[model samples]
Target: MSMKHLKYCPELNQITGSINATILLLQLEYWFAKMTGGKFYKFLDSCEHELYKQGDSWVEELGFSKQEFRTAFSKIGKVYTSKKAFKESKDLFNGKYYASYYDRIKGLTYYIRNDAKLSELFDDDSNKILYSEEKSTENTEDVLRTPQIIIPANPKTSSPLSVEYNKLLTSVKDTHPTKVCVPYETIKALFNQYCPSYPQLTLLTAKRKTLLKKLWYDMGQTLENFKQAFLSAENSDFLSGRLGSWRASFDWLIQEDKFVALLEGCYTNNRRQSQFSPSTPSAPKPHSKFTTMYSHYWDFEELEKLEDQYIDRQIAKYSTMSVALD
Candidate 1:
């Protein structure tokens, strides 16, 4: 039987415990090589590291329906053990063989296991010869070439990301690369300690992780910078719900715009004087000259009585003059 297009070892399916998983792994390896310009390995910080792909794209390209793709994708990390004496124990497996990080907005990023059992499968001399032949036939029409062999390095002890991203130090010269790994747990602790009034972060969800990573890269990529940002948030009365109903949350504080505004002291209390403060009572205006000259004669109540009596006399005189005329 001639298997021309896609050549994969049967052992791959056996080890991964699913034919779909084997196909998915091979496909990922093929794309990783293409994305990295024929290189077997590339660090996440490299310019060409935007390897996030939507699941639908994978489904369309791989000719698998959404359900099949999801099932295969989930099984990429699992490693099945060999058949045991008992049939019931045959399906048991050890730790995960891959590490993946899923950002709801950015899609999925994955790394293969760097252990010996999987490495031997790719590093075989036969596999290399097959890969060379595939590379030579690059111009062939409709020919899906076998993927290049990727020999990943031993897994790293300390993971930069969460437990999900453990064991991904793949074939780099520096085993401990100096990438700005976001210490999510430590930052969460700092946020809880400093911004006590804000909502406590019980779970580091995918959305929160995405925001935290963006913030770590955008602002200074250091724990101290994060600490300072949290401290600033703590000091802001507006962020603590003292000045307004809205309070700053872990998510809100780590947002790019809000975090920048916080570091710039935009929300800091300026302690301006209140608008309702009592003003100094103005001095009474000096008495006008006319009032001062006639101050003694100016009796408001007595003048009113005199004016009424004069009006009464005028009325009686007018009455007598009318009687004479008649």
Candidate 2:
């Protein structure tokens, strides 16, 4: 009970009342948000500095044939002091918490590019194959129609992402294939990630969902229509590159007397990845506040975009409902 950082508790049963969960989460969120301010991006910059330094400091110590860099970075990140303050977003694109936090998590699992140059200048093309999804670059923003949605103060209390996400992965009614949308349930995994030090039910409420559901039309259609809305969500997203993963990993860092680098086992040849964990020994440097702000500008912009998308979704839902009733 000294203070739990991030711990997983499989046996931690889901809360019975959504209201109870919502209230509890609201309390925790108050503190978490307070510590993670508008300057969240600056925090990511600091994380990068640490990753770069740690990677280099422990490269020789790891002694892997390929020279494991993430492990070193993870070890250092796990012990860093900041992990005790910020809480990470469970899903980066759910349009909830900052995107940079989400990017940090994916960076640990997938070696995504921050910029094009991060790709290797390999002597042979055969050596540089990454089984990544083919990125579609067509700007569909023009074809976009305003989507309708119900927004409550908190998605956790208002929507159950766990329930909705599970269904989205399955085949929807065969008749409706033209559109696809994400519901609150699909995003539950993010909210309920196990904090290894002390895992428990978040206890968020469903009132937000109830309010939106009544104010809006067919919730299913709202989610379905969102397919287009969310296409570039993870891409152009403020959390798109360095800040994304940096933030998420940083989120895991907060709340712990000791931090564990979840990315310790990850490997990447990407230059940004390498730079963040440069495999050299150097002392940590004091970060300039401006540098931190620069890294997170996208976060502020992304959150605004999400707010816009939510309003648009509500509009779309309104139209569809009227037509159906007519």
Candidate 3:
């Protein structure tokens, strides 16, 4: 029976605790207030709100009580940094400092609860004893090497499976769907160039195939996802690398106060005229060419409606334009 055990994830614990300690402490305070009828076990309030008012400035000028603050801080720090000793130690009835909502006695019995000793530190032994081991489920890597590797699938045979199998495939798992095998030559090349420290034999065809399948499968998925995303983009040309620095093409012009005639013509249109015509009849805003080509492309139909609604005024104004008569 395979079993798994919980070990401290040190990096995660350090990061989470450092950033969330203030929030956790406040939660503890709220719980304490509810459990103990709005009373705080910690003797003094934090300097900011309860004890001192803001903008007084003289409050900070009055100076800190080093002995009192240090005594309280040490009690809390020990609970965080030293878990083993803390879980095993006995609690004192009149400990000088205490964490908020901390249990003083177990199940309301007078017997002291180790969890509450204000100055106590948690030790390693107690933590080790408290943690329990659990069984783990089979994962992809494990499934790949068990039943398949048990009876060395005849690597020497050149059956349909045989052609795909090299000397290295004798140890793959039955759950593995692929008949493909890693050639001995690829393993030899990589081992020589990258991992000479380990015995070259360890990268035998079997192990190499397993490692390569995982690495290649993951890379293929990521690459395919990126391709799909780029394909779905509104500006397909930019993603396919056709408009190379077409993004930066305008940066120099704008920065140097220069303008291209083509861009200006596009923005102003060929005739420097507004597309709206009072008598010619107006479609809904969503259908407007300016909105479609210039503003963020809303659905063309929706743009027509918005334009029409805004243009439908009780008082309409008419304007004239010069048309070239040939």
Candidate 4:
């Protein structure tokens, strides 16, 4: 029989004390099974290891959110930095062997435990264990034969660790929809270059990160769009603090409504007015009433002249009709 599905052991939950960790362990076992030359004692030396990248497609394939995956992966045990020290027998786990090692450049590698309690679950012999589909519908006990543990009538109250674990699990279960990946540092750099006068973004807090990710996704997920947004802010008189004391900052620019307005040229400079002009200024010219409304495009003075001519023609036609009637 071909090993098509992963067999889950209830003992893993007992060992890890978490359902998320149990699921991750099963998935990791599935991956390890695919490695060539068979499983061995030490990680990166005896057995082949897989490098797990965060936010990879396999994470979703295993039905885990990013946060859930991270939490579950951490529960496995300490991740060693040095491969030499990790290979040493003294550094290995004493009783139940479960180790993880991480490198900054290469990424994360795991070593699943191969203890007697869970040995049968990881066995190469596929026919020994019954898959869910092959199991008899009458009883599930045949498929999962978990050893019964005697519990006291009055179990001890939950510990702080258990409470915190429960909270983490709750957060994992309540996962938000995956966000579009945004180049946050690149955007920050662009903001710094373009809006030099505005408040600089030194620290990217959790709230700011959330806002930026949302903005990047909403704004079509392009660096060029971000560039244009920054440029628009740079050219704006009000936003650049030329028109007012209050100036636009990174926080103000990322707001959806405000960003949309900025792109629509709402806050842009109306004319090419200089910031610092001569003390002797030119006399102000009289402008049409509609000047403020159409100042960006139309010549309101010409519009006023056209209106006067139309009124004159209408008056002349009415007088000519009255004279003919008389």
- Per-candidate TM equals 0.30, 0.16, 0.14, 0.32
- Candidate 4, residue 217: Cα displacement in angstroms equals 24
Worst 10 residues of 4 by lDDT: 145-154
lDDT of 4 by residue, 1-326 (tens): 11122234445677776777776666565445445322322222222336333323434344554445555765664445434344443434433334554322233343534333245444554324322234445453223221122111112433323556547545647633585677889988887776655667788878788888866765557888777777778766567665546777788888866776665455655666433222312213225423423435777678656744553454345445545654
Error of 4 at 37 (Å): 4.3
lDDT of each: 0.50, 0.26, 0.28, 0.52
| Lowest-sum lDDT 10-residue window in model 1 | 79-88
TM-score attained by model 4 = 0.32
Per-residue lDDT tens digits for candidate 3, residues 153-225, read: 2323333334343232233222335754434454345333332222233434444456545433322323332
Off by over 4 Å in 3: 1-176, 181-184, 202-208, 221-326
**Among all candidates shown, the one with the greatest lDDT:** 4
Best by TM-score: 4
Ranking by TM-score: 4, 1, 2, 3
| Pairwise lDDT winner, candidates 1 and 3 | 1
Off by over 4 Å in 4: 1-12, 36-57, 94-97, 103-112, 115-117, 120-127, 130-172, 175-206, 209-326
**Could you give candidate 1's per-residue lDDT for residues 1-326 as a string of tens digits?**
12124434445767666655676667565554455321132222222336633322554455454445555656665321111111132221223434332222222233333233344457677556445545443454334555443221123233223443223212211222347588899988987777666667789998998888767764547788887777777766567665545776777777776886676556655544222111212112224423322234577567645643543343344434544554
Clash totals for all candidate models:
1, 54, 24, 0
